[model samples]
Target: MDSQEDLKRCPVDFDHESRTHASNWPTEFRELRGKCPVAWTEKHGGYWVATRYQDVVAMAQDDATFSSFKTFDPHSGEVTGGITIPATPIPRGLPVESDRPDWNMFRTYLNRRFAPKAAEARRAKVRKYADSLLNRVIETGEIDLVNEFTGPVPAMTTMELMGLPLEEWREFADPLHEMVFTPKEAPEYPHVIAGVQWIFKRCIETFHQRKTEPLGDDLLSYFAHEKIDGRAVTEEEMLSFCNNIITGGVDTTTALTTHALVYLNEHPEDYRRLQEEPKLLPVAREEFVRFFTPIHGLARNVSRDVEMDGAKMEKGDRVYLAWSAANRDPEVFTDPETVDIARFPNRHIAFGAGMHRCIGSFMARVMFEEMMHVVMVRIPDYRTHPDRARRYTSVGTINGWVDMPTSFTPGPKIETGLVL
Candidate 1:
């Protein structure tokens, strides 16, 4: 097993970002977990995939050994140590893409807004957004749930929390929705890059403006004119932090919700069960999160030479912590492929583990619950058009649907009584 050929036998053909991987990744990950828990791949400039739950958890926890720090030089086209493999050409976001002391400051700043109690307090806002979004197409009977419903609620909620104009949610969110899964060779790739650049441009401007404006109760105002590590937060760090919030905030819950919609559409019994007993939505949400794993696996950079579960990782080597695979590992989950909504004590790593774990996780849960509960009550008879449905071309970054056209018995829209 130590030989190069033995490693190759672990199959050198895996590529998470490929179109084929979009369709066959679960099967491929299953094989990898069974054969080589930590296998190498030449794809994306060669990185190791840790499919075992224990190994991924270990790597995620030991951020010192597996650094989240990254740097991108736009002029030289040099990229190093980011969450994504092949290293994104764009600037890396804060906290998640950093290590140790620098990361801790950002994390602490964000905690005030994203902590469990803070997120819980946001349920009313989330529900109001969800209701308003549904009110748009509830009477149409036919709509693209992904475009109209799931996508907008989270985006608008994020904008509201940040004290930004709610009308501009789509402008800020669409590019990110496109960039996460688009293949590099696609004609739209350059467009996506431009949009991403525009995002940073807008973020930089807003951050600078916030500094001079009167402080408010919103998250951005709190961050505005803030000092970190004994100095004002720099422009570079500001843009990076803004990028992190937008990237992580807008799309993840939508991905999970759309995926669950597609699933429940295919399985009527599960839909009926949820509709019958609304209290079970939280349990089902965890199961869906575990099953879909919207953010498939996040990338990590090896800080120093280390070996885990017999995979000898070297300094500066890139690694992918396959949360999707870990969530489905037979060793950790009984009947791994089966979907049991009531599975308690589920040690799923869907939100990841350790220090750099998703900061918006509590916020995401509140968002999902409100949306799911509303959909269940309002669109109980809804049916998705799988034949015309569109999924992400490459699911390496986000395992999600692009277009989920659904039709339901036309229902009267409720009076949401909320205004931007």
Candidate 2:
């Protein structure tokens, strides 16, 4: 700690992607934020960690200096870097992993489709999906909400949006859900990678099918024929685009809703308030997003030498923006740990910041809100069994639960009349 070299080397021996280090994130990140806001870590090829709120925001905003671009060779299973510490072996996550003109080019084409109005338009379908999911487990009084409810609703919604068969939501979502929390060394990791690869292949085939059929009001139809920069969109671009939507769309919202629901189960006072005052749902949703901060951190490749919070990072060095750490910063939130539903002027970057910010954020909100509404109104007395609950082994990629087992008094299904 005394030497200059140790100072830049991140004295704490930080490893953001480790399964063992996940629980100690708060304590570890607090130290880094206080002692070295831009500390460099030997983990993940020696990347800089930005913990302070303003610093993280500043870096995220300046995409030119802090790039999200990365290259991948699917055939060789080689990945240079793209938006995650120790980047995983996957194709580019679309505009999220693109820089400058490419980012703008992709984002502009899809922005209107994911805009607030578009999300609002999809509300009824989200509610229908939520109600239908609960209908499956209501009579049994036992439910693993992560799998049966939270996971499927968003997956189904995403499928419906893509003009894919709603029944195949599992086929599309299961691999993504599995790949996020599973460790790289696990035996199933290889299978998970292959499953992901299959998803791209399916997307290509689906896009081609859509090209020949009559165009519809969906993403697949648009990508099948739409031109970007006066040229036809390639299958690679289509795969990247679909990958970003499917990957980013389903699991993050599931995680947020799962955490929020579990929190509600533990804190009956908050639940009572939310139930009695239905108008507080929207505000409470934001508070949950801020507190949970799903999609916690992402990486950016340094394009040039820049000094951030007294630490100088050279060109090509990777930097991890600790959005989770920034969300809990005392300077930004009055009491960062506590979940206050009425939190005002809340500026947490749960969805991220700048040009590369999450494109499906509004849609995510709709999905979360509908699911939250359905649970509170229908399963009022549902009780989660903590002993049987399982959380993600690693929150490095996404802070979420593996499963949450719950029991409730068996109730009759409310006929929604919508055939799923």
Candidate 3:
């Protein structure tokens, strides 16, 4: 096939119903990378597919040359598009889809919450919650791992971190999951959007409460009081800011936890190794995130006409940083296909890179590490129910298990008395 045809045939477009049912996505990506590193796919209504390690990495890092704000029109083939695939609609928030000074300003206020020390401070509480969830599962013998355990752990952790009422966690988590992994036209979309709106509204109300009462700890209090540009932030900005953190935090962490367990089940030897040498738990969590790449790709729009690898990309072109493809790139990672707990210099862009990198990365790392540690210590022999392994559908921007049925002999729950 000619280069243009080759680009048009790139298989990354899983948006189409036929391609959407794919069971072996990783293999498909590998095939695409080998055949055409920078191929264009007619999927997602036609967009460029960069499958190589270097291409994706460069696209992610070069914010000036590759902007992330263009909105693609599927029907017209217009490339100046939004960050989402299929050129769909979503409630806009600052920084996630913005560029430069504006993005930096918003990010600065939120970055403090996910700082390394702040994230570490939540470990004890996260571990307790993780263990408590597992305790419920251990008694059941067989549990729907995704819906029962993997999903709630992160949802609860995010709530705790945000200092929101735990009672509303399920209400928030269900809709967030639906919004990210299901089609927007689905019946669930309206409900999901409503749930998100409700959460944001509550956040706004809480901001008011915090302003008067001044709760010393938690994110809302910080945002309520924090000054930007030598003045207090506006309520709308605070709501959008909190929405960004909560929305991003809830689903991705759930996906990471689910993917990690699935990986452990698929590789029992690795699970046993982790159980034996608990010190490797942290490394294993990072490797799992890198290998699975819970969030598949992040989109960027080119701000200027740029030349990369002999190809000319025009101004306002939408460039996708394929984190999944990049994570498995052979050039950067030795045997990128294999999940090595000790993979050194393992700088994966799973959380992204540069100015737009995920602010919740440290918290995510802590949640994953603590959850994995608890699982390894308590339920060492957990295995997935092969017949019941439920892979998520319509997850264009994120990859995760929708339903994971795992069977394990839940050991006696250990009491690690650590306060939040």
Best by lDDT: 2
Candidate 2, 1-420: lDDT as tens digits: 466464464445788877665778888878888888888778766888889999999999999999998898879998886898888776787878999888889899889989999999999999998998788888998899888889989889998888887777778778888888877789998998888777777778889998998878888889987888889888888888898898888899999999899899899999999999988888888889988888879999989988887787788788889899999899888988799987988999988988888899999999999998998878889887766887787778888888889888888887776544
Q: Give the range where candidate 3 is weakest over 10 consecutive residues by summed lDDT.
A: 13-22
Tens-digit lDDT track of model 1 for 111-226: 77788999999899889988887887888898788888888888888877776777777776677777776777889999988977776676666666788898877666666766
Measured with C-alpha atoms, the lDDT of residue 383 in candidate 2 is: 88
Off by over 4 Å in 1: 1-11
How does candidate 1 score on lDDT? Answer: 0.84
Pairing residues by index, what is the TM-score of model 2? 0.96
Candidate 1 has which clashing residue pairs, if any?
none
TM-score, candidate 1, is: 0.94
**How far in Å is the alpha carbon of 264 misplaced in model 3?**
1.8
Q: lDDT per residue, candidate 3, 1-420, as tens digits? A: 676453333345543123343356677668767876765556655556666888887777777676655333446665445565555444445557667767788777677767999999999888888787776667667777766666777888877776688777678667667666666578777877888778777788878888997556877787778787678988866765675687677778888888878777888787778778888777777788898887777666667766665456666555566788888988788999888977777888888877778888898888888777776677767787746765666446567766777888756655545211
Error of 1 at 56 (Å): 0.8
Residue 111 of model 2, lDDT score: 91
Q: Rate the local accuracy (lDDT) of all candidates.
A: 0.84, 0.86, 0.71
Candidate 2: where are CA atoms >4 Å away?
1-10, 417-420
In candidate 2, the residue pairs with backbone N, CA or C atoms under 3 Å apart (3 or more residues apart, or in different chains) clash, namely: none
